[model samples]
Target chain A: MHSSESSEVEVKDVKNAGMPRRELLRYFFAPKAIAVIGASATPGKIGYQILYNLKRRFKGDLFPVNPKQEEILELKCYPSIVDIPEEVDLAVISIPAKFVPEQVRLCGEKGVKAVIVIASGFGETGEEGKKLEEEMLRYALYYNLRIIGPNCHGIYNPRTGVDTPFIPERRMAKPEPGNLVLVSQSGAFLGALGDWVSQERIGVSNLIGIGNKVDVDETDLIDWFKDEEETGIIALYLESVKRGKEFIRVCRETSKKKPIIIFKAGRTESGARAATSHTGSIAGVDAIYDAAFKQSGVIRAESLEHMFDVIRAFQRQPLPKGDRVAIVSNGGGFGVVCADAIELNGLKVARFTEETYEYLRNRFPPHYGITNPIDLTGDGDKDDFKDAMEAVLKDENVDAVILGIIWQGVVLEDEVVEVLAKVVKKYDKPVLGSSPGGEFSSMMSEKFNRLGIPHYPIPERAIKALSAMVSYVRRREEFFRDEE
Target chain B: MSRILTEYEASKLLSEYRIPMIGGSLVNSVEEVARTASAIGYPVVMKVMSPDILHKSDAGCVKVGISDEKEAERAYEELLENARRYKADAKIQGILIQKMAEKGTETIIGVVKDEQFGHVLMFGLGGIFVEVLRDVSFRVTPINRRDALEMINEVKASKILYGARGRSASDVNSIVETLLKLSELVEEHPEIVELDINPFVVYEEGKGGIGLDALIRIE
Candidate 1:
């Protein structure tokens, strides 16, 4: 048994070795060939899913290991990794909880560099299961073996044809990957989010769910994400942290180089207790978490909906100038509500500069709150919403704009959205909207998304998106946006 | 002197420094409890002044609003009997007869010495809010005037002190000055690990704040 003193020394050595950016990211995103241990001919099992998904999503070689079945998905199967007669980059284990230890030991002896154990009921179960997990970790640590998760849903990457198969429809994006990497602790939520991304047709470089991390955790993943050339943003959804101080330290260092957005769930007492039961984490005082988030340049996501909305906006829109917002509305109350929500979030409601007003004076009725949220006086046409947005985006003083369309009582929904989308695509500025108008809202939302802008249901949510952009721009100015 | 300071004796320590506190006097025996209650004026309070007792109400050592000398004497006897029964070996430091102080807006101020940074002072809403709401703020001791103002503003319910609910505003500067003085007191006495002045009622603009009840613990 290795002493903890030597373990600390090994950690220090790894810390100082200056691992290359591409190599670390490759460990997560682009492993060359993978072997599926416990691969089954039986459909709907985890092992079958692993083998089938790898065949469907990846171009790399996939070897399925099953003792009884000579073949799976028409590919020849080896009973164990040692019998493969070739070098393997990764071994993914999906055997039953009782057989995981032996499979991992066999993989280690095969000299595979990395492993992803897609088995549950390890540490998350009672004491007996925990003892087994400790043994697995001891094996990994002593042999310098890297493990993703003993209880995770596994990872997804488009660049290396290494899709983990949870996302439906292989072509989620145009296959043009960008610099956004998602690291979540909830496999259930991660699965749902991956579906959302596919449906929304958003491109992601890497999406990982590190459940109950007995080995690699958020900080470890973040340290790798910071150095990766293709990753510009790191989105995190954590139920709790393994080390709050260490996590904050890494985030503070990394967020200075790339935008870091985090969503936490254990704020309330009962919620905190439930989180502990699920993750075996002691969620300490909420204030400390608050201080930690603020100290690190982490944008706090209020809800799952906001998580997707904020990341999508950051990816497409230009950095907002400041918090100053302009609201264009077809109703007085919609304009009023959006104004209050915008001010409440610490963003200034932009007063139109003289040049912007002089340009738009002949464009609409004088009753509009043109200094603010330009109210189009209820009878304004689709051309008015378009013209007002164009003027606002071009003003150069306004950081972002939130437009409110009240509905059929005012103008045709399609016509207004068409005009708005044209202006948004032209300006290349951050523009958000909120409409409570039935099916019309959905149509408008689709167009807003099509134009590469974000739209929501309520005024408050739009303001929150704008606030995130303002923070991102400021962090970027500090040249500490996201550091490796 | 007793091992634990009586209400009057403790008041003397605060008094010597001109710390604003409710006026009261000490009386040694039951007969003196009646005489002191008469001279201090009727409708006063009689409390067991045992040096060993910190929370007089819990010990059943408090009798409030005594109307006359007879009532004061009887109430003082009841208090002595209860304290003796509860803490039998305790030294009876006599009764304290004080005029019933007028009620006003309540607040709590305290100083607790922390291991990392020496004494830290706290200010916030008192009573149930301190436990359930935790509406309080803290800062390391020896604070300047600006730091004192910041501490007061840090609490969520500080709007009440700044005149919420259509009420008259308390003299905020006086409260800030008192906090500065507290920071100084804690600095001068490192042995005082815990000191609390609960329900420190302050009157309208002219009347200033008063330390109605004080509990100080020292190493």
Candidate 2:
């Protein structure tokens, strides 16, 4: 056991010498060959789903190890991992809980580098199950096997086509290939978020459900995502953090390079009680978590919907240089709402320079107000929004712009999406939009998303998205400055 | 399960850590109280010292503005009577006579052990401001000087400490230094489960601050 542990440490040191930590998590996400320890022949079993999902898009080799079946999914099945002639990079274990320990021992002996345990009823159950989970962890540590979870849905990497989740593709919505990577502690939330991502058309790079986190916790995953080239933005849904100090340190380091948006549940007393039972995590004081998030550069999303909004904004826009926002609206009411939201979110309404003011005053109608919320009267057209945005975005004082298009206006047309998208692309600064109404607004918003423009349904949410960008910019600046 | 320490022991421990405080001493009787009060100064505050009593003022065991020997004697006797009236089983240690701190902004520094986060330091507006507004900021210790200053600046009404409303700015650096020292003290003594320095009077800038009243609990 000592030899195995020392050998593992040496391998890790050699692999990480002068190399980015991204290489540490390479096998888990991009394994060359994976073996399914409990690969089954039946259609309704979890093993079948795991194997089928892997074959659907994964480009790597798949080995199904099943003593009972000769071949499953038309692939030759070995009786066990030890029976395989070649070494395996990763092993997906989906057998019953009682029979998982022996399978893990065999996988370790076979020199499998990584394993994802997808079976349930360990640790989340009573003391006996917890003991079984501990034994499995002991074997994993002694053999130097990096275990993902004892009860999790598994992983999904759209870019690499490594879909290890048990849930079928049809039941869960699979988001398109994008830069955002999601790490969720709950399997149920991970599955649900996948569907939401698909429905919202939000792109994703990877989605991992870190169940129980018996061995691998948020700290390791964050260190990996800190330098992962494919991941542009990282999102996390956590009930509790096992290693608080390490989590904060890694987040403080990772969020400097890319945004790490998080949604933490179990804040209230009852919610904390529920969390402790659900994941066996001691939900510490919520205020401490809040402080930790602020100290680090991690942007905290209040709810799942809020997280999506923030992530979408981050995905579509560049970080604002400052907190000064310029609001452009067709209606005066929307302008007022956005103006209040900007200040309420610790941002300032950009006081345009005299030259930009003169330019906007000449472009809009004579009666249109040319204040911070460059109010284009209700009779404004796509040309009016385009002109106003271009003029406001020209001012060096304005770090971001939140354009509100009240679809109830007569002159507003679907062409507004193209015009706004063009203006947003022209500006290096962040430009967010809000179009709040019925079916027409929803359609336009989707078009806006596809055009690489983030559009919120409400004025407040748009400003909120803009606020998140400005905050990220400041925090990133602080992080970089401190490193120097 | 916390073990309470008398004000004398608490002050001795604090002084060892270089936490500034007004000169005073614990006296066993009214005669000793008079002698200590005269030695410290004319205007001295006296309180009944007892480990059982958490709130000396609330039990009417505190007397301030005692300017003479006669008042000191009468006040010490009254404090003893009040301590007995407040709790019959209370073990009266003696009277603690402290020189009255100069008027300034009242601030509080405290430390409490959290089950998961370990020792957390709390800083806030002290005295009636703390009771009325409940304004406080907390950070996990052992914090550096920058973190200590950040804690001082985190309170919503921290402007008052920075000379707001025509008031002179208090000695903020002194408060930060005291916080750093207290953090070190807690780090050195693991048995100190909780500590509070309430009404830590902050004089004008350049003048030092003093921990007017303190209570330490051990486990």
Candidate 3:
């Protein structure tokens, strides 16, 4: 036993020397072969649904382990992980609480590098469950295996098609492959967010649910995704942070490279109690968390919807060079509303350059408001929007533009989407659209999204999203400048 | 779970960190009070030093504007009597005699140990700004110089420190230095769970500031 222990230590040292700690998570994200420990033949079971989801997307080898079944999902089933012939890089465990630790030990003996436990009733239930979690953790530590959770909904990666969320694809639509990565401490939130992302057509790089974070946690994910070439934004919905100092350190370093937006729940006293029962986490004072986020350059979203809005803005548009924004609207009221929101959200209504003012005055009649909002009047058309956007975008004083499109106007047609999209592509500054109305406006918003412009149902949300981007840029600059 | 140090002990600890304070010495008797007051120069302030009496002013154990030895002696006895009246069995340390700090913009700086994030530093303007409005800013400790500056500038009443309404600008750079020093002090001494330097009077720019009163809690 002593000789084997010494050899294990030596192997661990060699592994550590060969790769950084973050690289260990690669097996979970991009495994060559995977084994489902509790794969079931019956539909609607967690094991079955997880296997079905994996079967649809996972491109690697899949092995099913079920003692009761001869075959499942048209694949051969083994009695145990150790009995499998091929090497398994990852294992998804979905069995009763009593049997999970034994399976974890077996996977450890089988030399699996990573394991995702989908079983509940561990650490969150009672003393007995907590004891089971401890046992599993001991086995994982001895074998040097990385565990995602003792109770979690599992992970999904669009780039590699590694879907392990138990919610079936039909029930929860998987988003297309893109740069936004979503991580949630609550599995149900991820499930709902997945549907929302699909509905909104927000492309995602990965969706991870870290339940009862016994081993892998938000800090590990942030460190791993900070350097990931495919990930451009890291968004999280957290009830509580496990390692506070370490989380701050990793986020401070990562936010300088890319934006990290967090929607931390449990701000009020009643909410803290609910969060405690939900995840068995003590939500510390909310002000301290706010200070930590600010110090680390992490953007804190006010609500769940706000988080998605911020994510869409970061995902689709270039960051503004400054907080000065120019508004273009066909109606006067919408322009006025946007101007009020811009100042309230810590953004300035831009002061146009003389050239821009002269150019707009020459293009439009004297009755038109040709200053900051650049009101194109009720007769505004696609050509008018194109001219206004181009002139303001060309002005050195304007860092961004917010288009308040009242789609109900008679002259404003769907062709405005293509025209504005083409004009925005010519400039590097961010441009967001606000078109508030019924089905027609929603349809136009989707079209705008496809063309790389984030449209909001309300002008306030659009301004809020743009303000989040501006704050992120300001924080990034301040953080880097302090280092210098 | 924690022990609040007497004002004398708290002041000694602050001195170790080089935090600017209205210079004072602990006096054991009426004679010593007069000597310390005269040496530090009047008008001096005297307060009872006792852990049993947390709110010194509330207990009527604090006296200010002592311009002579006779007044210092009289105030010393009065403070001791007040301390005894407030808490008969209170453990008395000594009388703390500090030179009166010149008036400027009043500010507050403090540190509280959060269960999750450890020590967090807090800064705000004093008086109604903090008491009535609760306008303050916080940062996790071991902060950089830039964080210190931001904490000072983040408060709504920060304009008062910057010479708002025809007032001269206070020594903000001095407050930044004290905040950084306090950050280092707490970072090195994790057992110091809580500290407060209330009504830290700031003089005009380039003249510096001094902590007029302080309280320290340790676990």
Candidate 4:
């Protein structure tokens, strides 16, 4: 709701820094004119693939830079960025590393808004590559040119059709536009993750692969995304943070308005060594990062899978009002598992109010256990599920609900998906689902996903996701209290 | 890389930060030690004052519960003898005679300079529990009273400090005050590489606690 005010303040911050911040990012993601340097005619070349991907839906002026080819892909080709007639906003440089410095110099000479250097063999190599990258950074700073990556896959803003990741559409999956923005340090990792996201139909607003963040780091992008109206949540996959103190401060401010989830790599000695070699980042003591995250109220995900799970939950559900969770499952064993997970995550298994207990008892049969985990026996049907869920949701003490549908019951069918979704929306409280099976469960989960209900394959994971939602609300309240 | 400060020097530093310390005096001779003990009252404690001795109790340089002047004199001699036997090349400055602090729950408050995040403050239940259980919580320095309060409650043994099992609660506010004051001191003095107040005696509520021993190291 306060996004507009925060965005205005961000615009002023960008203006004070001597760069129109909003326009600069817009140029990279939704530029009116783009110059693709090193444009190639060969179908298999990196430059050719980038141009092909942009031609799909980039509703802007596209200029191909190729000295040899006069006309490539039906667009006039220029030798360099300076040859372009119209004022170029962004330059996608995908040439050899040796020729990148001069191209960047020309980009600065032409007053380009931002440059995404998609070349490799810098910094990640050895001392020589490090020196070369240092020289490249010098040129970018001297000309006031903001850079995204020198060895990264670049950005993919599906909302604007700005696909600069050098991968063709045929080889990649493109999901629809949604509100989650993913910022990753590893370009290749984002490549594979993007394909998975596409297959799972997980919509994203922005996908940035920040490789060798010399001129622009994660904090700079975080500051920009904090006020973005389209961004509902910000998720990061980082090996190291460049500016520690500023990162904490910005996150502390942003997390108050939008939840920030991070999947920090290099948590172990061996993992740290691998990260240093991969990204050339000096991953500091893991404990210090832990303390910093706690101080800033940034939710931490244990792994990539866990990050996706939590992000889906945050994207699908509203922030849980409290830590008290009510578990309603058809399988008694699953309820036991959810109970263990809820307590393990420091969440209480809410004791249903006397009225809620009485209501639940009438909804289900006398044989069904009507306690906190109101176990609706194996014979429970869609009506039993809806009645029990609605009863518990009305209880003042119950904050959230986790419904486990085994799907193997004789009376249960796919209709339960809509029943659960309607009740969740009516109450405006978070409700996570668990359906663990093979083909039927997977198919039913997609149906649940469409209804904006995050369904986990197991009871423990569903409870963990619900617990994360609960913690985000609690942490934000703590921050709000501090502000007061 | 770090040099330990003497007991008297550490106490003066703590006083500068307004962290209360048990009243003590550094006396040079046996007669002076006895006189100081008698002046402070009976059942006093004596320790060998030397920079070379980091762990005074382990080196047998610490002697507590002396009832009279004669016992204080003997403790001084025994401390000197133990200091010599442990490390003959060590420099023995004198003896520090302090009033015996009343028995209370022991706790530890310390700070370790982290390479990435700067100074981090640590608090936990003191004595053997600190070593065995390792129950502690850390926060970046320059913490306010609220942060200090959270740090105290973050430790599991905090229940013990909150009057567990019908015992009177310890003066938790005093520990919070000490934490805040230490944070200010560490921020003011960049050279303070590490500081430890092990066994910070926390008395009953309404009666503030005192630091019986303090160690400050400088780069």
Question: Cα deviation in Å at residue B89, candidate 3?
Answer: 2.5
Clashes of each: 11, 0, 0, 0
**Docking band of candidate 4:** incorrect
Q: Estimate each model's TM-score.
A: 0.69, 0.90, 0.94, 0.87
TM-score of chain A of each: 0.87, 0.92, 0.93, 0.92
Best of the candidates, TM-score: 3
Q: Pick the candidate with the highest DockQ.
A: 3
Model 2 fnat value = 0.04
Give the residue spans of candidate 4 off by over 4 A: A1-17, A20-26, A65-72, A95-103, A270-284, A353-358, A361-363, B1-10, B26-53, B66-97, B217-219
Put down candidate 1 lDDT per residue, B15-116, tens digits, no spaces: 666667775877777767776777788889777776588778888988887898778878877888898988999887677788877776677777655443
- Rank the models by TM-score, top first: 3, 2, 4, 1
Going through the candidates in order, their DockQ values are: 0.05, 0.23, 0.34, 0.21
Interface RMSD of each candidate, angstroms, one decimal: 12.4, 9.6, 9.2, 10.4
What Cα-based lDDT does every candidate model obtain? 0.71, 0.81, 0.86, 0.81
Stretches of model 1 off by over 4 angstroms after superposition = A1-25, A165-179, A271-288, A367-369, A407-419, A425-428, A471-484, B1-129, B136-154, B158-219
Candidate 2, chain B, TM-score (2 decimals): 0.96
Q: B1-219, model 4: which lDDT tens digit per residue?
A: 767787678889999889998849888887787678888998998888888887889899888889987788888888889999999999877888899999999988877665556666778887555776657777777676777998899889999999999999999999999999999998888887677887789999989999998887787
State the lDDT of candidate 3 residue by residue for A3-113, as single tens digits: 112223325532222333355588989999999999999999988888888888899999999999989999899999999999898999999989999998888788787
What is candidate 2's lDDT per residue for B1-219, written digit by digit as tens?
657887777888999989986637888866686678888988889988899887888899899988999999999888888999999999988888988777888888877665555666778886555556656667666666766877888888788989998998889999899989988988888787677777688989999899888787788
Using DockQ as the yardstick, the better of models 2 and 3 is: 3
